[model samples]
Target: MEASAAKAPSTLAKASRERRDIVSGEVMDEARLIRFVVGPEGQVVPDLARKLPGRGLWVAADRVAVETAAKKGLFARAAKAKVQASPGLADQVEMLLRRRLLSALGLARKAGDITSGFEKVSSAIQSGKAAWLIEARDGAADGRRKIMAMARKQQSAPRVFGLFTAEELGLALGGENVIHTAFLAGRAAERWAEDARRLEGFSPLLPEDWREEPIEAKREP
Candidate 1:
């Protein structure tokens, strides 16, 4: 019990990053913060990977926070320069994050660290070699339920995420009916988990509360 309690913050510190919201003057973890950088034309751009080279501007992941920051000229003040914040900045961020996640998924497939279809994914989970489970938002209920049940029976359950639709998954993976995807235990899986979590933070539509447990089907209501 002591060890479990001691590890909570350490787990969080490693899973997510921390930054200050320029709009509200509040410190927010990666789960609640969206990072941004100024482009060559002085336009604010969402840095979802946090790899953009420049001073970062952070705001709460909420749409309201992004809208306020752009409308109120808070970014200009934070950067100490005439930076332009697009009125459509929030929409832009969502689009960028969405694409980034799909791209990551594609890369995982190319690296052979991701497998689609129910049978293959189930095998991966049962083998204790899956680090993450991805269910399509439009997948059949029974398929998702069986996968989650398998994940739960594991001694160390893998994490679960449901953020994309069947169509999106199919397009990204170059396949059809991609109801479920299991990320094999490897470097690519780790990278996918990071980007997936960031996308989950920005999009409330994602099933962020789902985990590898014997549970009902997880999806956006």
Candidate 2:
């Protein structure tokens, strides 16, 4: 009779099982990795790959988590010592998040996935191709209202975000200066939307009337 295939040793099987157990927990979960560092006030600021100096602390990306962390000294606990928590740390994080969103929009413009000028943006909306409606925070109320109305007319009703000034928009789009822009869905748009949402969560400005509630808005007759 042909020789039967040799059975693996029981000790070898046990060693293999032990090796598997050791490697299981050794792997880091990407989803659990922290992307932001908390200030002493417990504001979660993006570490931009977590390369910043000093020990880092993390909090969830929400108002409740941030407020709870700040109120309870959770960050100090995480840092294992007392640290100065900056006043308005949340606002600072919001600003940084806005800048990141704008940067993503800039990348989309460079990649030809975005367009500016009122007519072009309007056309994009009409064609249901726009994924985001970007208007300058300092733009005229009438102009913004018109653009927003056009956006609503679109089949998809893309998200409208206004957190940057006209000058900032100009710098991003590489034009004389743009107050209105639209982004089509793609990698850039996805990144921008994520950043914008985070910024909105932490922005000091409450969402009510973007036009009528400006800090410097003048009363009209």
Candidate 3:
């Protein structure tokens, strides 16, 4: 008889694995932390992929924590050597994260795991096929409300994200006015969700004002 195959852990369980923060010295979910490394030039670099070829220096993903690490010379202390972390390190990390998320979205589109436009997205949500709802950060309030309303009617509403601008969404997905999109259930969708969650640490998935409404949905698979 063949031995039983092991099951893969859910994203929630995987994200729960802890990593120690060099700045605060607190152990927290790895997803809530950002990793860094010292370059050959002795400059601190954000290793968002956590695969850079050096010992990692982890910090909480919050802008304040990143700023504190840079301003207080925590990267040098962690690296045990002189390393330059620019004053605008936090801004740089945020830019990189935004780019990474957009690129991942493009890949999802190429993989045919995404449906764009208001009509198709509405269909995806109504049919319970979408696992994520991607709304442009600059999208109109009426459009957002309509999508959220449809999501609320679902037994398992898709997680909503408003992290990219309409132009950015268009450029990434190769369409004009790509204000709303939906990620169908698949590996590509899962990958995009992972990057979106990582970027969420640096920025709110939805605007703070949206919190007053019932917008959130099911957790990641």
Q: Give candidate 1 misplaced runs (Cα > 4 Å).
A: 1-20, 24-33, 51-54, 60-64, 205-221
Best by lDDT: 3
Root-mean-square deviation per candidate: 6.6, 11.5, 4.3
Write one digit per residue (lDDT tens) for candidate 2, span 36-96.
4555464445564457765556554445555556566666666666654454555555666
lDDT for 167 (candidate 2): 94
**133-205: candidate 1 lDDT, tens digit per residue:** 8889877777788888889888767777677899999999999878999888887876666555555545653
> Model 2: runs farther than 4 Å from truth?
1-34, 38-56, 204-207, 211-221
Error of 3 at 6 (Å): 10
RMSD of 1: 6.6
**Residue 26 displacement (Å), model 3:** 2.9
**lDDT (Cα, 0-100) at 197 in candidate 2:** 51
- Candidate 3 C-alpha error for residue 80, in Å: 0.5
Backbone Cα, N, C clashes tallied per candidate:
0, 0, 0
The lDDT per prediction is 0.80, 0.63, 0.83
Which portions of model 3 miss their true places by more than 4 Å? 1-18, 208-214, 217-221
lDDT of 3: 0.83
State how far residue 162 of model 2 sits from its true place (Å): 1.5
Q: Is candidate 1 or candidate 2 better by TM-score?
A: 1
TM-scores of the models, in the order given: 0.74, 0.68, 0.84
